[model samples]
Target chain A: MIEIVSAERCVACDKCVLACPTNVFDRGPGGVPVVARQEDCQTCYMCEAYCPVDALFVAPHTHPLPAGSPLREEPEVAGAGLLGSYRERIGWGRGRVPGARLAVGPDLDRAGPAPAAGRAPAGPARGARD
Target chain B: MRLDADVLVLGGGPAGAWAALGAAEAGASVVLADKGYLGTSGAAAGGGNNLWYLPPDPGLRAAAIAGRQRLGGLLTDVDWMARVQEETFRQVNRLASWGYPFPRDASGQERRSSLQGPEYMRRMRRRVHRGGVRILDHHPALELLADEAGVVTGAAGLRRQEGFARWEVRAGAVVLATGGCAFLSRAFGLNVDTGDGHLMAAELGAELSGMEFSAVYGASPEFGNHTKGLMMQYATYYDERGRPLGTAGPAGRDLLARRLAAGERVFARLDRAPAALREAMRRSQPNYFLPMEKAGIDVFTQPYPLRLVLEGTVRGTGGLRLSGEDCATTVPGLYAAGDVATRELVTGAASGGGSLNGAWAISSGTWAGAGAARFAGTRGPLPPPGALRPAGRAGMRPGGPGVGRAEVDAFVAAVQERVLPLRHNYFRTAEGLTESLRLLDPLWEQARDRLGAAPGDGRTALRAREAAALAAHARWMYRSALARAESRGVHRREDRPAAGPGLAHRLLVSGLDRVAVRRDPVAPRLLTGAGVP
Candidate 1:
């Protein structure tokens, strides 16, 4: 769920509008942002992360229930932009790019922060690029 | 407001971009309009895909070209597919020159991956931005404007900037590239694919064909599009008892169905791929591994749960029927390419994603763009605005009162509930289609009466139109399914399990009030190879 905690703090940079892939936000009459497509939010935090004033709070769905679980129980898929294909479509653990699956214990929560994404993470084949 | 152009392109995806570029470069004043910003919108913005490239080896290129010719028993336009096949070599080269930075081997050869996505689009958008074509962002054409003589003059679209207002474009020719129908389907960037081009063209009395093949269903555990083994012969499947079901292919579908019959949950797991394959996945999809990381389940190590659902018609077939030598539709002054036109190139049971579609977007867009410009030169100036007519007096908030959010949501939900369920999906039967049509009719009725939006709020208006288009799209797919009494390719029928012995006929549908349906054989089969006449 995404919440603009303090709308007053918003400078109306409209960064969220540009950052959004699904276009969940619409500019209202006074340039106030409205969650016109709230149901479509994939919770990628692009909006929150891009918000300079820290006015937005985004709590992404946890990994307690696996994806592809029945609908209405929870969102079966994520929004289809930026991180959506990774978190929703390309099911990988530990890293965004392909590699030997990261070692995780039986308990799901202990799975640490994702291996650094975007810049091909250091796979077992180290120093292969430079 | 009035905008004049020699050619007007009504979408801004790869196809639309190339179309605009083609027309503008050919000295036609072209204006490309997109509902969102150009270059960064449509399926392309989803990111990291091939705009059609091949491995450096001559043998691999020949094999890929030979293999694609074999879809749906030579369903694609051979000339068109072959043309795109050769054109992509240059298209990839052009994308690379624009700083796409495609991953290469140690020998500096561009490594090729079968999976396609938005990376190519990202670079293509830069190229489009550099192309200097006239572009209008946040402007979606609401209706195709036609002259009294029935030739399309231009289009009327809505722009949602400060508030909602109408934008009109006067053009000698228009290219419709609004993509295909993927009603509520998640894969293949179906969210924005509301079949706008189909509805607008159909409103202008254009015909749609091969809609029965619109329901192509496949299984992908995490992400569907570009997932190598999801539908292809690559992934390993696990049944409810955790028994490995072997590699996925046409036979894997049988395994999937059998597991479903046994009430076994199914999953697709990727084997630990080597660095080359891993680099290939990253270069093509880039984000394919994120979902697994989020869930703490490694795809290479752990099994990912997959579901079988109908692919959006963007990957199947159904759109404005292309005719004659050019990519022009039956409606004159109108042309279509990419996902919005008849997919004669993606025939048979092959999945229509990645390089095939990427190539089509670039090549067909160029084809339609050049064709439209040539036609524009052949014709006189666009007719006066007063002489042009709206697609209809009713569909556009044309009624007594427009609908609100509630009615529009209800209409969308109605289709989601009625037509999109698996029961009414891939395995279409006479009874199931009849029921689907029955449920879809009331929603159509509701669309006629209540589908409306506030003027300034273009989002709601877009949703309302999509709701109507989704209904029409579903109706066409189901009606076509009912008309085709045999099973073939993606149009699976429980009662009729095999491709019936007859000429492969494309189902053509026209009109909105009383839809006209007909079957026309695919003349000039492209490949003319094994198992087909």
Candidate 2:
């Protein structure tokens, strides 16, 4: 899933090794990073962004519902407004219930009061479009 | 750095998090540690869709427990099963309170969107924060520290700071939520799963069962690497000639078996699935959909390639044995929960995802947390550092010798490639397992020497520690596989496909020096069926 274009460019700073949440990359004998476990890539792209050499190429990546943004793109929290979605989901805005729904599933679905009818139909992210 | 807690819970997955929550709620000074940054690690890193809580329907509960008993061979602890089955709703409610998003129908009944995504952990981490429990992110427990009498008083681990700082935790009680072995699985993009807790507990003479049973699953052969699992029920399978190939369950074992026997490249007819089912699946498991879209494989009009995913440790059996009492290990003051703990509650059932295990993580974790907190209440001060030491200093890495990153990687790859997955799993045999060991034992002899770390590389060094843990675990797993000559559920041996009536038992493993398997009989409980009226 991840490929280092040319090993010659790799300075072996080990940033890619450290950046991976899945421990996807292990330092090769020559100090260049290798994708020994590509199947576990998840296409998160953390290794690509973290590689200081800019030698990494992750194959045709898909945007991960933008959970919060760039786990593989930028150095930022991916699930940005995820907490707000949480509050809306359980009928609790800020630790307090907005409506009389008991903060459980059956109760919140019927909802005395709430945010909106739909969220990320695919996931809880605020939007599906960029 | 050194720190102390009344109860220290290892790992930050659902189990450890819930364990910490339960312990903190019980008024213990709890400290939670993880190898990865908490919340964003473990199998639940994405978020969990299936929250297999017990339904209020009485007959369903009886039938569910009975089904598991039939599959798992009556080893299910009904008392523990009853408590966790009922109490897991509290875990679900706690998640809801923290704003975990579970899709509900117009009728407002909760829907199974997907098995864990980032959302589940997002709420869990928030709860951990609110619980006021002390946190140590990026701390992986390497070894358990014991007093003169062999009682566990604390653990020694790496803090994973600059050059990987040495760290120590003095605890009144320790819970091993370190999870199971995933790196050993096929399709190896090696993550943090190297069976640390399994090896660690084994070193201290903990008993492990179900090692013969691996948590193998199926995925789209075309997109298996990039995706988790395609919503199989919504897909149709046809051979290259368009002949019907049998479908797979949540675990995919059935599908794999049929395909293997038929000797055909089966393609899932996702195009035939109704729009509503496809849409529902997409919303439930978005990650599965994103990859399909990216790969240009539309389930609506096209058939997708299917393959067997050998995730040995995912729902794989073989973990620290749980006492019906309090999830404690044979070692006093030490307990295990989550994947690190064997599936005692659902022992006789299929190890499917969703509510079965997701809820198990929360339920077992909750009980262990409270049980540990109570146990901690009676603990005395930790023994002096000098008094607490491993029995063997040089041989303390447990099963083998020293090695470096490359060696460890190669070893893991070998296990994934030759020793495990298709060859050693599902289709099992005494000869196959024995042959696997014949290849693995030499590696074990060389494993420690192979698992080494340079002075400067902390990340590799941490992996080195985990590699040693995995090497030790591999020995135990393979040994048990060879010893258990019968097939049941995931532990299907071709030479012995049918489980012998007498062989419906457990094979306990420890003593890495000799690597012995002690078979224990399945003692069926008569009076304590959870919902069987």
Candidate 3:
């Protein structure tokens, strides 16, 4: 099963989810993709392949390898962007650059303080970049 | 009441069925409990999962090419994701062939492949029952049974049959495939979804991250666009022409850069008639761009022109933070899966394989269930909470005639009219958000008046569930909207018109009534935004 998108990297775009066919995801609060129907996954890398930002991963089970093909040790399932492959060769970087998972967090100053009840907290910006 | 079983699966959807059968097949007694009739609720309950986003070999080739070019360096391994695709294809095919009557394609192949939750939920019920899993209907897990130190021991709940009856069941481990908080949102007065799993996890002290992010998307037109999760295949946008339109763009690395860099609203622009797009627009009435003809003047011909809606904080990301194969929370003996567990595997709609993919993750529940069983071996029995508490007094309030049903309809209409298509579109601003909030608040206040306790037997339970779901979903929508100050992904803030260079960071908050905020580490690195590296 795929780990939930990190608080920082997930923009809640639902791209990783929309590309799926199984209704594996549902809109959690704040529009984030929630894995509502997970058991239906067939280990097909469709989600990992279609995720613009590699936000998803699909791995085979512990079952033996299929015939002559070697069992994949660590499947790095890739995602396809919304634009078909044709535009890819043309290198259109304008609006076609799909997202990928990132290892980062929110820059505090830009986002302001987290809310308390209905008001913003007065603590130091904790997620700010050093 | 005492119930014994080799396996006790909470949800009756695909995952639950698989968990029960997997264990049952392995020679254990299995009991599956569901809030609704088996397979009648959830995505598969309506029908089978939608089409595979990636069509076999050809689709894979196309996606691979697009991934490299459109996504730049962001795409992950194609082979692995393809494997996932292959698995889902086989599973769905097997289920349909095994008597789950999906709509057939021209070649007689079942083609009901869609992410439509209702459709998919229906199909799962038919097939799973055939697989020999014991199912209990209309039973909701009221609470987890725990030991003196709070270690999870089992579950207690109400079986809504003739009356509100309490029951207890013992299990080694429990998997919470209860879906997400869409229902909860309605309960809390949010425009979007409820935080069901989030609330449940929190009550058990499971650490949650990503509440600040919600992934709102253009609902598939077929599904009336009421539910999200279908924006991955096509990139909807306007051309130089000022009309609504769309294109089958690759998933990554293309026309999105300019907007991402400039912090413009990124959404789909459909090419159909306005009337055809009305239903989708009504439900999510998203923000959109007018496709421009060559020189950016003439409107394109397509009328069902739709665009991605990013008005509020509809990022669907949150859950119990996990460290490894073990999905342990700060609290022991508790386990979660589906949307509630926040595991490390994810993909787009086609990429994610929708409902079919969920079946694949049942192993997590199996593992958790087994682990729970193992823990139970050493732990003493837990004391039942006696009686399930009444729907708390804090949540009880009378419906005031001040906000009538008509007002809610009008409010929904007004929001659809004023907020959507304009401010809620790809290009969002603080001012737009503020304006939208103002417009929505009155209706929300009125909706509150419509909320109250129902009088009756099990009917009240059903009503209460619906009410709670609505309240929870509403709360997230409202609070998330207020929290986000800039445009990102599905959220576009007009006042903060430019994408922050610091796109790598995120916002984290806590507290039920008063949320506390903080930022956790950036999630696993696979896709970097336009600039923020």
- Highest-scoring model, DockQ: 2
How well is each residue in B227-326 modelled by candidate 1, as lDDT tens digits?
2222132357886666887655555665675565355778876663443454344333333444344445566667777766445576675667888556
Candidate 2 chain A, which ten residues in sequence have the lowest lDDT sum? A121-130
Between candidates 1 and 2, name the one with more favorable DockQ: 2
- Please compute DockQ, using alpha carbons, for every candidate against the native two-chain complex: 0.06, 0.07, 0.02
Q: Estimate each model's TM-score.
A: 0.80, 0.78, 0.51
Which model is ahead, 1 or 3, in terms of lDDT?
1
Q: How well does chain B match by TM-score in each candidate?
A: 0.89, 0.89, 0.60
CAPRI classification of candidate 2: incorrect
lDDT by residue (tens digit), candidate 3, B1-533: 56755346676555565555555555555567766455443433322233333447864534533342222122122333344356556655655565543433346554434332333444455555665666777676555555556555556555654255766666554555555443321111112122334444444555554433333333222101222222222234553454433343323212443344344534443322244433432221111111021112222234232233321222243445544443445556665554454422332111222332353344444444444444445544444445322222111233542223333334444534433343353344555545655655554344344533344433343333334333333334444545656544333455764445554344444444333445446433343234323
Candidate 2, B316: how far from true, in Å? 2.0
Reference-based lDDT, residue B36, model 2:
67
Fnat per candidate:
0.01, 0.04, 0.00
What is the C-alpha local distance difference test score of each model? Answer: 0.62, 0.60, 0.40
Candidates ranked by DockQ, best first?
2, 1, 3
Ranking by lDDT: 1, 2, 3
For model 3, the docking class works out as incorrect
